[model samples]
Target: MNIVLTVLEVTAPVFLLAAVGFIWVKMGFEYRVQFVTRLAMTLSVPCLIFVSLMQTDIAPQALTALSLASIAAYVLVTVLCFVLVLLAKLDRRTYLAPLIMGNTGNLGLPLALFAFGDVGLGYAVVVFAVMAIYSFTFGVWMVSGGGSVIKVVKEPMVGATVLGAIFLWQGWETPRFLTNTLDLIGQIAIPIMLITLGVAVARLHPGRLGRAVWLSVIKAGICAAAAWGVGIWFELDQIALAVLVLQVSTPVAVTSYLLAEKYGADADAVAGLVVISTLLSIITIPVLLIFLM
Candidate 1:
């Protein structure tokens, strides 16, 4: 019973903030998605990642274990999701990325923060950074038939991850004023991400919802199973293990839909995934949290 309440407490703000964005769009408000996304990803999210990694108290050995573990986890997930897509006889380009890449940015960050506090957020960011690197590089190449190294290197988030990792490894710190400035910028990342999630969902036009429903269920199950097995195999600590499971099992990200749309690969199908997977998370996340907490 207490676990249930704790799960609700941890999970509610994530959904509620997104609900606000959803409602805002429904009430005919104008939200500039591209602008907001650019702001968050370029400025706020980078600062958040850099500062979080630089300041995290997690031991270097543990952090190193997690970094490697996260890479292995995603690689395994990609194989599992790829096989699932093939068996389902779906279009590989459209289905594979969504299946493998979850909403670690928008939903995963806040959930980690709320469920396990700052330390969880630190671990969550590591996983998120690993996923982001894979998503921007390999995920894009899979979807677009070609991805550029130059383009991937130019991404602010990618730069931040590399810089932050360096700082963390070297025990370096920015000047006090600079660190505080970055911290303030980083704080806005969570709320903006959550709200953007809701807005994206509200505005999505989903198709093939019947297929989406079943596929979403399958995704949740496969992701949870895979992440759990991987975390155990890695022998991560309690918080790190929980964060791994939680981040890996998040719903399909809205970015998947945008990528599909941009690449001309059945945007509606991806939108169905974003909608269905996210709705499914409302149930799956709370249940997962109940167990994790």
Candidate 2:
């Protein structure tokens, strides 16, 4: 009962608010979505990263464990997807990004924080940092058609991660007032992101949902299996292992849509995957917690 309630409490507001945004967009308030997305991507997200990093005290051992676990999970998922593509005879362009990139930053971070509090949030930060790097570089190369490597170097997330790392390494602390202000700003990110997602869903045509659902199920199932097996092999703690599993089991990231749009990799299909996978995670995540937690 507690777990179910927690899930409802955490997700219901975001989903409902996003649904409202969707209805508004359907009623022709498209401009509002643009404003929300811009706010989320620029001000709220960066502040969230800075504030989260600054507030967390990440020990060297924790950092090392997180890095190793994250990299291992990433590599395992990548290889699993590659094999799936070959065996399933999937279109290389369509499956590449969505299969490998889970919703680590937006959905996973918030969920981890909700489940395990500050320590989980710290672990999530490390995971997000690594995932962001992979998404920008290798992810772009996979989805984009002959784009220059320079595009990856110029990503805002990359810069934000770098700046956050520098602050962490320097052991810099924000003034309490500024920290509070950033916290307030950062708190807006999750809800806004969910609402923007709802708007994005409103924009999605029903015709594209079938293939997306199929791809999402495959991605989620395979990734979950890989995460579980790896967690056992590594002897990870319950909380850490559960976090990794939940992160991996998340839907194909929204970034997959952006990548598909920019690089000509079946954008509609990718968008469908993102939406379907995310919705399905409402089921898959709790199921994971039932055992892992």
Candidate 3:
């Protein structure tokens, strides 16, 4: 009973902020998604990652372990999701990336912070960094069949991750004033991201929702199982293990739909996956937190 309340306390705010965005959109409010997303990714999120890594108390060894485990988990998930897409006779370009890349940023980061505090956020950032690098490079290549290494290099989030890792390893810190400033900017990331998620979902016109529902269920299962197995294999600590599982098992990201639309894949089909998976996460995430907590 206590655990249930704890989980609710952690999760309620996330969904509620998202609901705010959804409601705002429904009420015909002006929310510029492209501008907001660009601000978050280019500025706010990078500050968050940098400051989190610089201030984190988690040992470098533990973070390294989590990073490796995250990579292994994604690899396993990719293989399994690939097989699922092939066997289901789905379009690989439309279905594959969404299945492999979950919403590790907007949902996963905040959940980690709420559930496990700073240490959890530290661990979650490592996993997010791993996923982001993979998604920008390999995941993009899977969709566009083109050079994606440059995209990864060009991403501010990637630069921040690398810089943060360097600071963590070197025991470096920015000036206290600068640190506080970055922290202030970073604070807006979670709420803004959550609200943007709701706005994105509310605006998406999902097609083939029946197929989406089943695929989302399967994706949730595969991601959780894969992360669990890899965490155990890598011998991650309790918090790290839990964070990895949660991050890896988040709903399909809205970015997946954007990528599909950009690359001329089945945008509507990917939109279905995004909306259904995100809606399904409301149930799945709370259940997951109950176990993790």
Which candidate number would show the highest lDDT if scored against the true structure?
3
For residue 222, give model 1's deviation from the true position in Å.
1.0
lDDT of 2 by residue, 1-293 (tens): 87777766655654576587678788987446667777876688778877777667765455667678878988999998999888878788878778898888667777787777777776677777787778877787787655455755676655666676677777887888988998899888877776677777777643268777877788888889988787777777777787888787778877778778777777877777877887888788777766655
lDDT of 2: 0.75
Name the lDDT of candidate 1: 0.92
Q: What is the TM-score of each candidate against the true structure?
A: 0.98, 0.87, 0.99
- Computed on alpha carbons, the lDDT of every model, listed in order, comes to 0.92, 0.75, 0.94
Clashes of 3: 0
Please give, for residues 16-60, the per-residue lDDT of candidate 3 as tens digits. Answer: 999999999999999999999999999999999999999999899
Which residue pairs clash in candidate 1? none
Model 3 clash pairs are none
RMSD of each: 0.9, 2.5, 0.8
Runs of candidate 3 exceeding 4 Å displacement = none
**1-293, model 1: which lDDT tens digit per residue?**
88898999998899999999999999999999999999999999999999998998888788888989899889888998899988989999899999999999999999999999888988999999888888888989889998677877898988998898889889999999999999999999999999999999999999999999999999999888888888899899999999999999999999999999999898998999999999989999999987887
After superposing candidate 2 on the true structure, give the runs of residues whose Cα lies further than 4 Å from its correct spot: 32-35, 146-149, 166-171, 206-208
Error of 1 at 258 (Å): 0.5
Backbone Cα, N, C clashes tallied per candidate:
0, 0, 0
